[model samples]
Target: MTFTFKKAVRSESKLRLALEGISGSGKTYSALRLAKGLGGKIAVVDTERGSASLYSGLPGIPEFDVLELTDSFSPEVYVDAIHAAEEAGYNVIILDSITPEWSGKNGCLELADLYSKGNSLAGWKKVTPLHRKFLDTIVNSKCHIIATMRSKAAVSMVDGKVKKVQDKTEQRDGTEFEFTVVLSIDRDSHNAVASKDRTGLFKDPEVLTEETGKKLLSWLSGAATISPEIQAEAEKAAQLGVESIKNFMASLKESKPDQHALFSDAEKKRLYVVARKADINATQQGK
Candidate 1:
């Protein structure tokens, strides 16, 4: 008997980073440093009051193009700008703020909790084919992406002391943590850490000062040479993270543990068919 197999499409080694935290945490500073260390070629989406000017004096950086509100504030604008950057020969692309670009329309609010909406998966649906251009040109354009997000902070009184808390911000103005290297920038010596990488190893909560950015750049520099064993671990984490989300959404549609409310009974039953295909893909990818 003869067996036939098709060649696999190779994915490029690219970096997608999200800078999260309080205002004035120096997210841009960190991104520029990362870019500087990675061979002096970088692109930035200057949404944060001209993120370009914010770092004009930084080492190894010459100048940056402003992400005009009229241009990228709309989703279509994002596609145009990213495509232009890819063609302009920048080795790294920076989206200064991704939240303002997302207009909460056509069920965009549903993805308020997932990274797809802005930086997560469900946000992907909100933007649709329009956003796919971003994923391809920005994510797959053979360049590093350093996106800065305006952090949405929750406030609560802990023992009568009002404290600002960090959580998933709203979609229209902030991004949810899910599918990138999530970093919480704070005004101090400490910064919160969350890794949402599906294609690479993820780190845990660690302090992110200027020093942390240097370490990340070092790791990113070596990502192309990651060990096979480590690669397996990262992929598993990615799958587990995405799978957990699917199950969470499924549970919300149920009054009974095994029942779904959002979809018709017939539609819910078809999940098994999709799930079987996912399993096969996972196995082939060694996830």
Candidate 2:
């Protein structure tokens, strides 16, 4: 019901990156290279028939675990894969060719079509929420996420000749807006240019390598700060007695499931500890 303001500060956060290129532009290899530079245990959710595994043990590419999704590319399937990777302690996850989730077999497009049974508009109404949830999972995930998307060639008449140029990513329009950085890769050259770069790290098109990931990691580690609103919430939560904390959490889970889901396991543990401390302090004061 009230609003407050504070000095804006950048927090050390996980990466949300996207690589867009046509087939053979090396999205998988580039994603792995960047992950290697980012430096952590890595996992890949391969929707491209285990294509990611082919690069295993290659030079400059660190070994990574894989979860191949051969059948379904539904948003829920991707969400579950992300959670599984997070639970397994992966620091980075590469979603190789997220294009499938949008257009491939059993993807959102298919789901929409099936739901519509003839009406395209009717189908999206049912599929939109699931798609939003999938995007949210990527945005709020604890681990860094690098998603690859297939791009279609854009053609134009240049000097009365139709020339093929590329830039359009094949997912839903504006999907690039969700990522902190979006690299558009050239198929012939394998070079990448940033269509979007919130971090101000990239200036020109260049070949992606392990160093690219390392640069991102270095930038991400620069500083950290929490918002005033969250600090106030933490204080309030700490003041709650143990029983009250339990009740509050339950209520939050029921009423604000999305917000409750954002709390990492470690954060929940800290909340419990603070609440217990407050309860203990109250008991001591009564003595």
Candidate 3:
């Protein structure tokens, strides 16, 4: 194998964001605002029992579709909801509190227990594939995705003084890595910090709003009106780690009729190169 270097070119990409905080940290509200700025029909996979809808009809927020995942927080349900949103042609889908899909009722934790039979480490093996499927759904989905996660926080007495501190996400470990950006918030102050950012667009802790979404869109879009289908295809191929570029090329050739018409020959080739690079990097890291 040989390496080839070429001048870097910019390509549009979808936003994969995770907003995590303790209760009252404004995750849902902020997510809605950001989704609005991304600009397309928006949908919310509300897992917080209608909490997200509370902000609906608010003064400045735009109208969006909401699919409430009540009762069970199953991973399969979350996956299906995302797929349905994409099929419905929504531009952005917010998974409010993906944490429960991991640790809540019938979630990954239960699935792991069913397979593990007592050994926690062995249980992970059973649950990992399911979790990976959900992550892949997020990475490969056709629309921008913003997920919220609940964080554990509590007060403790240190030297007879009370203070609050951050704790782990209610979801399982390593879930945060699935997102391109992860924003953590202070529960009381309602300020956010970009704990993880691949784009380097955000700065220190601050409030996130529609303007934040606008800023994100500025970088995500350029003169090129990158079609949503192309973005979806690139993200999926990159994250799936498909080994054969030839097979990927075949898939692109057979894209949906509309997408096929929209993507020019040069654009197809560019997207393939990008997907190939992403797959190669994913393969290397997995090794």
> If ranked by TM-score, best first, what sequence of candidates would result?
2, 3, 1
Ranking 1 against 2 by lDDT, winner: 2
lDDT of each: 0.54, 0.83, 0.77
167-275, model 3: which lDDT tens digit per residue?
8888877887888889998876777888898766555566776756765665565423436766675556644544544455457546532233233344556666766
**Which candidate leads the pack in TM-score?**
2
Give the per-residue lDDT of model 2 (tens digit) for 177-230: 889999988777788988899877676677788757766765676522233564
Candidate 2 wrongly placed segments (more than 4 Å): 2-8, 154-164, 223-287
Worst 10 residues of 3 by lDDT: 256-265
TM-score of 2: 0.72
Clashes of 1: 13
Compared to the true structure, candidate 3 yields what TM-score?
0.71
The reply for model 3, stretches above 4 Å from the true place, is: 1-10, 119-122, 156-163, 222-287
Q: Is candidate 1 or candidate 3 better by lDDT?
A: 3
Give residue 118's error in model 1 in angstroms: 24
lDDT of 2 at 196: 94
The per-prediction tally of clashing pairs is: 13, 0, 0
